[model samples]
Target: MKGSQLGEENGRRSYESLRRTAQALETRADIARAALRLFRTRGWAGTTVRDVAREAGVSVPTVYSTYGNKQGLARALADAADLTAGVPRQLAELEAAAADPPRQLAAMAGYDRRLFERAGDVLRLLREAGRIEPELAAVYDDGRVRADETRARVFSSWPDGTLRPGLDLRAATDVYAALCTVDVYTTLTAERGWSPGRVERWWSDALARELLDR
Candidate 1:
């Protein structure tokens, strides 16, 4: 009887611990989502840790302890979005289609479209906020560098005759990155009221014309 009671007590404690860990993960996700929404609607400078805490239905200390600060929260939000969006899988698909330059470029454009659709406002807010916050500025610059590198790699994978005459791999990558930026997406879809499908088609067509021989 004593041994059975001890085993049941240990089991109960293990269950409680698992429950607490799950709740913590859920709380963190809630906090990240709240921060992202606030950042998108209010702009980074306008949104505060208190705002996130309130929006997340948690205390300020809890937000602070969980994420450290607003910058931390923003980073967490970006990380969560990236993980949820499965960017690596998209990149794999793009790489696999590299033998077909037009198809590869279209896949790249499609990836950009999906990224912007998921987090355009958040990215814009981060860009604006980065001007004032050094940490965020670093994060923004790192993202740009990574994007440029990815574009350069994709451009490099193509055959010599693919790009327009007089355009080297570096320049082509630069142009491609600029054309597929979140800012352009926002301008076309949010400001100019172009449909998402139209934006995607435009991206595919523009990249094909600019980068491909045919």
Candidate 2:
């Protein structure tokens, strides 16, 4: 009977620990969703700890306890958002989609379109943070370089590749990313107010001529 009771106690302890962990994760998720909503609407400076606490349906002290401070809260919120977005999985999808150029570039275009459509919200959050939080940006998450390498491999072996002589796969891929970086889109569309059609035409021509065409 004593052994039975002890076993029961251990089982209960395990269940309790699991329950606590699940609750903590749920709370953090709530905080993250609330932060994004608030950040999108109120910008950075206008949003407060109290605002998150209210939206998250938690106490002000609880917010402090969970995230430590405003910046810490923002960092946690971003981390949580990344997790919810399944960005790592999306990145894997990106690599898999790279088998075809028109398709790979299209996949990239889809991702960038979603990113740009939410530019106001994203820019506001970034502006609030000023610089990327060091902890959030890690060397292990260098998927961009890996993706670039993959593109280089795919492009360098092209039948027409020899025409570019010393350009090489890696260099060509690097140039591809440089040309398609968000700054280019922001510059042409947001800064100069170029028509989307015009921008697309120019981009398509540039890619076909410089990369695809012999």
Candidate 3:
């Protein structure tokens, strides 16, 4: 009888610990979301950890303890965004159309268009904020490297004899990366007022003409 009672108490303690951990994670997510919102609307220079805490409905100390600092919270937001995952999934889907290089290029452009349409604002905010924040700058640089690598992988996977004559793999990859950057997306969609569909079609046609044989 005593053993059964003790087992129940231990189980209850374990359950409580799990509950507490889950609650902590929830709080952290709340704080990150709040910080991202403030960063987007207020800009990085204007947003503060205290503002995030107030927006998240948690105490300032909790925000600090969970994320360590503003930079830490920003990093957490970047991770949560997982900007790296979308490209690979899109590329993988392009495998089925690999036999037709033009079609594959079009698919890639479609992917970029969708990605920017969904996250362009957040990405622009991060890029602008990185100018002032050293830590965020590093994160932005890392993201660029990852994006470049993805572009390289896609170029490498192209069927032989498909690339335009005289364009080396490195040069071609560089051109593709440059053409499909967040800056270009922002300029076309936000600055020039081009529609998302128009931008996607242009990218598809442009990339195909630049990278593939006539």
Candidate 4:
């Protein structure tokens, strides 16, 4: 029947469209991975779009068409880093413990550890690159602001009297954010050779003791 044929054609077109979308996403992921490797090894200032294209086995035009420029590629790499770091799952853990300040703080520490373990290189790369690149600097600044807001929201959600005496929500958020910074993590883990487990344990205990009333 004519109606049946029309439905079949539509189904075929839908399938083709889905396939193309998946392919495009896969290509972008490949480019991002290639860019990450180059950036990590050569530094952002040293890596070029041509190098990324060669590493990804794509054409230079493809790289330009896909990402626009180095900044766009950096953004893609940042996104991929978050995905590899399981940021969504970590956020969920924090959200699930919203009612329990101690548990929430512990989850925050866990999130910090996991993100550093998986994406510390990417973060460090962006931070170093941000010095010369205005766009990258803005991205880094935005990340800091978001991190502060996230901690503030978590602190604001706690029940009354959760914080230590004389510590307000804003103060608690500042303390938590300060302790959770990537610089602190790198200092202990990279400079002092402390294990991530040790850092997490210390942070968890420190956050609880500093922010929560006995």
Highest-lDDT candidate: 4
Error of 3 at 186 (Å): 3.1
Q: Give the alpha carbon lDDT tens digit for every residue of 29-88 in model 1.
A: 888888877876887768899999999999999999998977787675665565554677
lDDT of 3 by residue, 21-139 (tens): 98997887788778777877897779888998999999999988988888877775665455432655676667877677778778778777876777666677677878887888887
Number of the top-ranking candidate, with TM-score as the measure: 4
What are the per-residue Cα lDDT tens digits for candidate 4 across 76-189? 677667667666787898878877778888888987888787788888777887898887877677767777788888887778888999999789888888888788999999
Residues forming the 10-long window of minimal summed lDDT in candidate 4: 79-88
Itemize residue pairs with steric clashes in candidate 2.
Answer: none
Off by over 4 Å in 3: 1-32, 48-68, 80-92
- Whole-model lDDT values for every prediction: 0.81, 0.62, 0.79, 0.84
Runs of candidate 1 exceeding 4 Å displacement:
1-34, 41-69, 80-85
Candidate 2 TM-score, true structure as reference = 0.53
Error of 2 at 124 (Å): 5.7
lDDT of 4 at 69: 85
Clashes of each: 0, 0, 0, 0
TM-score per prediction, in order, is 0.70, 0.53, 0.68, 0.78
| RMSD, every candidate, angstroms | 6.2, 7.1, 6.1, 3.6
Model 4 regions lying over 4 Å from their true place: 1-28, 57-66
